[model samples]
Target chain A: MNQEQFEIYRHLAGRLIDGQLSPGSHIESEQELARKFSTTRMNAYRAIKQLERRGIVSRSKRAGTRVSAPVNPNLLRQLKCEMTRRICVIHSRNSYEYLHWTGEFRRTLQQALAAEDFTLEDVHLDDVRDRAELKEKLLRLTETGIAAFILSVRGEEDEFLIENSDLFFQYHNKIFVYQSGAMSWMHWPFHTVTVNIFGEGSLAAKYLMEKGIRKIAYCRREISSKNYLDFNRERLLGVEFTMRRLSDGRNKPEEWVGLEQIYRNCMENGSGCGLIVSTDELAARIIDYFAERGAKRPPEMISFDNNSEYDSYRLTTIAPPHVEMAQTLGRLIFDNIDIDSECGFVSYIKIDSKLIINHQE
Target chain B: MNQEQFEIYRHLAGRLIDGQLSPGSHIESEQELARKFSTTRMNAYRAIKQLERRGIVSRSKRAGTRVSAPVNPNLLRQLKCEMTRRICVIHSRNSYEYLHWTGEFRRTLQQALAAEDFTLEDVHLDDVRDRAELKEKLLRLTETGIAAFILSVRGEEDEFLIENSDLFFQYHNKIFVYQSGAMSWMHWPFHTVTVNIFGEGSLAAKYLMEKGIRKIAYCRREISSKNYLDFNRERLLGVEFTMRRLSDGRNKPEEWVGLEQIYRNCMENGSGCGLIVSTDELAARIIDYFAERGAKRPPEMISFDNNSEYDSYRLTTIAPPHVEMAQTLGRLIFDNIDIDSECGFVSYIKIDSKLIINHQE
Candidate 1:
């Protein structure tokens, strides 16, 4: 194509690809375009002919030139290469306000993507009332030129995705499942990022013992009846395994009923009691309970979910590394954006939770 | 000003207002301006003369027409009015990584502002090595035409801000302090928005009781030695006051040692026992401990901070209205953007924590 023809073709195609010129929209006539661009009618004719040949537009005597209703796949792919900067995050609705760390996860992810001139759009998958609604939503969303889709998979949501597995499997390379631990039951191949719950437990136990906790209690939360994915069991194994190994099979950390019982036992026994709570929320409760009563902080303690809320707390916590998680998702999406699923193997990224110590004594 | 002159003037002022033309930078000469805007040199000269009289630019044979060195007060005010769309958030460095909810707050604020085309720039005020350094950094930042400032105050950071009260007091209308509760010691006449920690406590207790909790336990964490500003007391008072009122002075919730003890006690008591944990973190622990043991979730329970991390937990939680808080701050900043400090009075906005019930029966 000559310079003028190339210019006109690029302008029209760009707008059509962006949906600014929808299907069936009439393109400017050759004479009209020739006047607009200050070019010869022949040049305008050549540009329209080029577009028509590519199947991006159709030329007819009565219709003149109209954008192809279905759009050309090759042209759409080119548009995706240049304009696909949106990442879709799937989670339950209103999780940002209720679910802990989700808001942080989203913020970190958004900030990371924004730096690369990409955007994060949240899709509350749980809000879809039924399987059919979810399927329709996913179909429409996937059809749009989203660079990537991040599914913060939970129980019901996981089931929903699996039900629509065929659609997801087709675009596996473009999908990522951010989970707490690998689900052994469900097996659909996609890029999976898991925070090592077991490692967090092990790390917490080790950190507490190193702080001279003679009697370490792994005070896990009572399991919810609705908990199909119980990470506490995995965490408990890590804590128990680590304690046995560190103590040479002598000192096993006891599973306590609740923080209050542990605190009472520690007070009665008179010090050197360390705690490895299940989550930072639990650890914070322990801290607040002691503080309200004017009691000193325990000799040592650690908890998981190094949630950003407890940054001021003087307690060691196991953080899931939200920033790293977000970055990993961002990196995976970027690397696999153009990759074919056939060549892409299912990648399981397991990141160990870090022990953040804000405790001075 | 004629149409040509106005066009040239608007173009130049917009650039200067946007900080594209920094103070002391030489602006386009009259001849250059005439050629660029395709206007008569006399019209360009008249525009330059208007800018000079407005104190936006100065003319000298050696310097040519240059932006004013000190930048005229009125011109700077106009720049602020037209271009100050960037909000400054002061927080500890690396907070986005470690601190809980701080990242969420920042993200929420950024999203809220971005809708209005405003950008949020974070200032790691705690990263400043010394008080002098902090003062210098703040002086420079405050000098820039920032729309408004939001200070997420903490201990040492709060002290630093207090020490620089004189500077903050001057820009009181344009400054907002987002705090957990009011600090009685530091009396700065700035627009203050505080999350009602006391109300959260009261709400939690009331909700737990309403859930048919007979034997109630108010679990608070042990206070850290570094916890100079203890909010547990405020929360405890709220809980105690509400409990006394609700029970008609017949029953009072006992402050427990930790969640384990509460769990053990509740199990022993055999149902209808309720727990009011200080934070959502603590409440999550109770749920986890119960879940770990395969026990039913305590008959009734409530916690505070409604931190987004524990959204999946079924327990009702008292959540600091972060969205409301951010919106309030944004609204205050926008409404008062052009108002003089003399005409604006200090605003104390207290938002009650919402009771987010994810628990069923």
Candidate 2:
């Protein structure tokens, strides 16, 4: 396989693999091939002879060169099979609505996919409002001749999936949904992955409890945005459940408080008041609030999403496995693409979150 | 190597591999070894001498054969490393409290783990109720010297985790949790997996909307058992979100009506009203009620967790990917066990459910 032969072989293989040069396609004469590659006619003949020897094609001076046709239908399908290496990623409005983390998530995922030789076919659905429009957008995106997708959706858009149910399932083998709100609409199984936000909450409760902090004040945004209602609600439920388990007739905090109230109340009431804030920024601010008023944080404190910028702050927080998640997502989508297995089980992948401790600020 | 020499060599290799014959241990004399495996004294001598040639052991007339001290710490550690293939599995009281799906989930998961050569060490927590007792149970389970776990929790028992948080994190690398109630506890990072019920709800709402049912009544138990409260709540929220998205100037039913009311109200109201029941059984019953009343079920209907037994009923139900969930659980636990990278990402796997439409009664 010399350089010219290798080049010619690769080009032919690509065409054959992509079905452009399907099982029965004919190859050009040696003279015509020589003109195409600007190579000698003898060299073109050698390339055709090589293809003939491999049984990829039948060649003769009288009959010309024709790709070998399969006798069996299954064999022909196998020979004509083309793999989809290009991936189109569509993030949910929720990912966009909360720009701080999800925005970075989208970028990191794109980079990771690119590194894996999966070219990105970006589908912008950041403005897909209401169920009908989301359906239209998703259906339109699927129609763009893209065979693979990584679609993220808030639960609200799932109704659109119900509208395009069969179409989605037909391609479910090639579809991956991340951080989806469509769990209920799972009439069809496919690969779905999300960071376990609810899990993050339970972890926080247990951590504060481990520090032997009794009556831990559960903290979060006094009023979170609507898109994150489910996120905030589920996490709070986890903390409350743990708080109940630990209460044990102990004078635990009576209510879930906001940052200002929790900080003020806990600082004023006592030091045994432990805390679990939903975000690291909120956690750091609570710490700062105490410091500004010439007080130290309660004995126990933990936050969510360990913001690396707050390394000096040294607060314990749950770290989302963003990099590993992107890697795993890429692996699952490519590794599990069996177009005919649409009725098979849907994999719900949950990437582990880390609890980072020890900070100065 | 002769037959006798090969036999002698194999026996010593087995002992060395098993760490039964560690460094500084002296091998018996050739005469003494001749008694074992019925090998000749010469063959035994040859085996020890061969070991000496390979620097695996030292030989001296007085000392007999002594295993050599490892020169490299890494190599020593590699040689000393033992595999942990068994996992301790604990199911929440909630999974048990209900005798239907969750029990099946527990059994299927156990079987799946066994098929993968991973045995489950069932940590009996059926009697555990109080936080202290749950803590005691967890502490006792960990003490069994089993490094790996697959703990399932209802958010209720998360306090016990807080009790043993430190001990849990120390062995966090080997821990896996399924059906976890402790997602809120993200105190330690390890593998955690659970089914996403919220996704199920969104799927239901989408399905109903796709049927063009405007007044979709959300139906569920007026007051479910404490264990399934979060389960029902999250799903209903998914439906409500979709309902809100679908609701325009059209007159919609009041939020979250009871089962009896939904069946009665929707059946009387004719074709415009649809229903998204919380379960297939509930949906089937609702349909039956309409049938019994000599009325046709509304144009649109969707349910959760399709009971395959009701094949004749032909209900569209979201079937939980239990088998696939269990299999994925087993694969993720074993596949992601990077013995070297201990304090790393532990994936929280969420298996996707299937929505079966036109499923026979």
Candidate 1 CAPRI category? incorrect
lDDT of 2 by residue, B1-361 (tens): 4557656765775577667888899877788888986878888888777667656889877777788965343233222222334577665544332422265676777776676466666665569776667556654554344537666664533345444543443323366666523133333345656555655766777677766666767677666555446556656655665555444223333444565677667756777776777777777777787788787765677777667666667887787766766766777765664343343444555555667888443
Model 1 misses residue A89 by how many Å? 1.4
State how far residue B257 of model 2 sits from its true place (Å).
2.5
The runs of at least 3 residues in candidate 1 whose Cα sits more than 4 Å from the true structure, single-residue gaps closed, are A1-83, A94-117, A153-167, A170-173, A180-186, A225-229, A259-270, A288-297, A308-313, A339-341, B1-361
Candidate 2 per-residue C-alpha lDDT over A20-105 given as tens digits, one digit per residue, 9 for 90 to 100? 77667787888888889999888777777666754679976677788885333322222222234456666544432242236566
- Model 2: CA > 4 A from native: A1-326, A332-361, B1-86, B95-112, B153-173, B180-190, B202-215, B224-230, B236-255, B284-301, B306-316, B336-343, B355-361
Model 2 chain B weakest 10-residue run by lDDT: B73-82
Best by lDDT: 1
CA-lDDT, candidates in order:
0.64, 0.60
